[model samples]
Target: MPVQKMDVFDVIVSGAGPAGATTALFLARAGKKVLLLDKEKFPRDKICADNKTWKCLDIVKELGLWKQFQKLPKAEIYGVLVASPNGSEMYTPLHEKDIAERGHWYNVKRIHFDNLLAQAAKKEKNITFKEKCAVVKPIYAVHSKTHISGVTYHDAKGKTHDAWARVVVGADGSQSPIAKAVGHSPVVKGRYATNTRAYFENVKGPMDRCELYYLKGICPGYFWIFPVDKKTCNVGIGMRPEDFERQKKSLEQILRETIALPQFKGRFKKAKQVTAFKEWGLSVLGKRRPCAGNGWVLVGDAGTFAMTFSGEGVGPSMRTGKIAAQGIVRALNENDVSARNLKKHYEDALWKILNPEVKGFRWLEFLLLNERLFDFVIAKSAKNKELIEISSRMQHDYTLSKKLVHPKTALKMLLS
Candidate 1:
């Protein structure tokens, strides 16, 4: 922990989020020296629905850690209910009566769940976990335009430390320092995304299931009420950055009005706000080249790999981190840590896991914004099982439209 001593690690991971921690866990399992660094301590709170999807469960199971997660306390689910502005409802059941089938998913507190996962990496003997460390700059091997060799960071004591590694992985959040250091910085615009959220405890009025409300003008940006516990839930709204700007009200003010709706009037009357409402920009990935360069690779939000539709990143970040680690392991084994070698594996792994979903979400996003089209789909899907199922897949991938039977119904409606 001394700043005077320069530490050399085989792989240095920045930002101990899902991606970074998973990368460290995999690297340690591979018998490599891994150093995991984070600006904040473990078990931190994040703004999200905190629900792990079926796809996420499958990935966790493949990692051999699914059983452990199953043992944790889980939220009960009857089904998900989608309510449209026109009073139409689409319900999807979460439980499967079939013996061979699994249920949809479970919701948990990120404070507890993320800590548990991060602890898994800490349990590995080869991984060095450091908290309260902010990465200041990436150490480049050649000139500033070349490969990154390591990082210069400041620890909790405000003492600076230089870490040298063959490869560095940036698993930081949307606002990634490593990404900026590597020159793949997020381009923030008022056009792409606007964030607003409020968490509630003791929420009432028939919220046993996840509820999504698609307000008419809000289009692509809907409101979500996700159950966190029997008595606690996260209720918030997200909209296009442009729409949010036009409202001329703070996100908090808008959220207060949203909760005052007829449906939520009595339910959240006594609800407690766990945290103050705030807004942050969502970074929609631009058409950038690969996220990895010589001796450096980016994972999770640092790489702009978040699927914009659902605004969920934890599961994807974990998968991305694991893939980045795998590539590092392969390159290290071959004694070739070139950016090209590591990038090929990282990019392939990311696209395989997320590209389809990203495309699908983008399409849904487009439709959600088309007021007339979105209203038609919502109204039509209210009672149509086929329409409901297809629209649901939009959250997974917008490309589902291309594969849906009778896709013309929605396409023609939207186009018209």
Candidate 2:
């Protein structure tokens, strides 16, 4: 097969999801030539819970895309409803001030959400957006095998091509080829989560909030009901891969059983599934891994920046992309694309912003492992105004979440 040589760019971002698109958009806006490639075409569906919090909205607002985002088909999420294994439920509104200021958070289908970002990237004059482009591997420097120089991919016509870039970003999801080619691995074992989601029509429930059910059978994980629109809902379940495999039950089976539980019986009685159950892997954020190296950087799931407790990746992923772009811009300006330089500016800065939350969420996940402990926390939050306020604020601000995981607070929750 003849390999075609394409124009060299300042940055080549693999996987044009939220991370890739955000990175490309920022780089392009800064006047850098960017090549954004993805395996799937636009308007494609991606496996996700479709939930977006204030953090995500902040990014969208920064990009000047909030008005456009509001125009997409979505459901407003006023708060979160968490149900414990023992049938105890608690509703934590997403910060009273935030609700009053922003109305509500949102749940938009990934297909639409991703397409919106990709489309925005397309409008940037410096960005070259290409769909149906599948990146195969990182192209290493001939003299140094460890240094990535560019990438080789197959275009829509099945033609192989070599595209060079000063920096290659692995914004791809969990199973990223660039991550493996760059010798990056998950820092923590059993940190990945397996999730399955499907769309349902006429899901009988209040469409104003997202629901999370923490059952005994799936400790450390939860089943979610996220409304996507007036008549449709994104229903899904997530679990640690080991726990999922140990149960010896398929996601579909677990989901079926979960819906039939006494608490959710009537909610699905009038609901009809409109889509097949689709499974995906979430590389939940835990231990920090190498994200930037010679001529390459990883963002999104490829960098394992997804939230540990909520499996929320969109906000973190996009935030990392923005941060990575800032670092890349500085590296390009300095004419230094070496691993040492990129790692110092990119990885270090990214970790500075992400490490605290990742560590805090990891501890929270640990506490939720015990059914009785988890139930106690949820039940208490229902009656404790202080605890409920802290929980609600934690969803929007990581600083507040740290307080919840503080030794003092943890001890109080444990004893109470």
Candidate 3:
């Protein structure tokens, strides 16, 4: 672990996923030299259903990547279908349109989507791409007792290289080496909350619809089947670690029982596992705290910006990266890299944009955990046209506002 010879960059991004790629894109576009490093090569794959909502689309457009984004094979997910443990069901469609205003969201394979974004990042003149480079640790200065100056990494050939940057972005994700090297402790405990996901292919269904089955007693979590393509889908269940402990069943067992439900048994008969089962402990959420110190910041799952209820992070992660890039660029322009100054970017921009949504999602998570309320919503949702319409809209703010009905509204929904 001798410090390797260093090459300098304005920004050294540790992860080449959506967040890191987008951050590099923004930074490079601003004329800052960026070195983007990733442990995986291009066309790398990741777990999770690959879905992007308008929250992410806006950033794609801002980065002038909308057109390319459109070229990918995308299935328009009309809305989500939710079923209660008791068998009652509801469908919610997403609202928003592209050119013709046809659909509000798109689903594509992450392998393709992530590589596409990274390719876009490569097109930037100021970015130097390094794939298969595993970051070892953050290069820190003893004097400041703050700020990560660079990173030391090992390449596929066992060659070690060090790269220095004015600022470091730990977009390296949940198991971030840079985050750990910088003295950031893992807040997510494996014993408390953990998630398991399994990916399958050749599932029978309309590619445009994703389904969520809410099981009673499994509060704050749901079973999901997200279609990635005509032939593939992400079938998984995420619940409290305590639930798994109590039941003492494997993740696959829960998932198999879920697929055996009458609604899915026939449709998923042809499905096959394309990837091995995967499990990861989610990072503990940092509600309003600044994710950056003096010279480094963490984005994406590394910062646990995933929605507590939905477990959706792709859009928010990319958005956070863009906002982080903006902050870093501004700090560089002002010749200050202090955490206090850089904190303004997250405080004024990133958190403000996502805080309400996170709070709303947290509330929904709690409500879903309450079996009485879960049952009430499912039963009422089937008959409540207003609830159905609002649910279909896919706007978190609107949905949360309307869904938190008062007694009068509740009466109206249930009676009507």
Top candidate, metric lDDT: 2
List per-candidate RMSD values in Å.
3.4, 2.3, 3.0
lDDT of 2 by residue, 159-260 (tens): 998899999999988888999887766435778778899999988878989998888778778999999988899999998878788889998899899999
Q: Please list the residue runs of candidate 2 whose C-alpha ends up more than 4 Å from where it truly belongs after superposition.
A: 1-6, 100-103, 186-188, 402-416
Q: What's the candidate order when arranged by decreasing lDDT?
A: 2, 3, 1
Tens-digit per-residue lDDT, 1-416, candidate 1: 76676799999999887778888888898999998999989878776667676545656776677778877766755567766666566776543441125455677777777777788878889999998998888888765567788999999999999899999888877777778876665754522567677678888766556787877656566788888777778778877867767888877777788789887788888889887775666665434447777888888778876556566667667777778888889988988888778877777666765666655555666655565655666666666666656655543345775433247765654454
Give me the runs in candidate 1 sitting further than 4 Å from their true place: 1-5, 71-73, 85-87, 94-102, 142-144, 188-191, 206-208, 285-289, 391-398, 403-407, 411-416
State the displacement of the C-alpha of residue 46, model 3, in Å, after optimal TM-score superposition. Answer: 0.4
For model 3, the stretches where C-alpha displacement exceeds 4 angstroms are 1-5, 96-103, 187-193, 284-286, 394-402
Residue 197 of model 1, lDDT score:
72
Point out the worst 10-residue segment of candidate 3 by lDDT. Answer: 95-104
Q: What RMSD does model 2 have?
A: 2.3
Clashing pairs in 3: 93-392, 97-101, 202-231
- Lowest summed lDDT across 10 adjacent residues in model 1 is found at 94-103
How accurate locally, in lDDT, is each candidate? 0.73, 0.86, 0.77
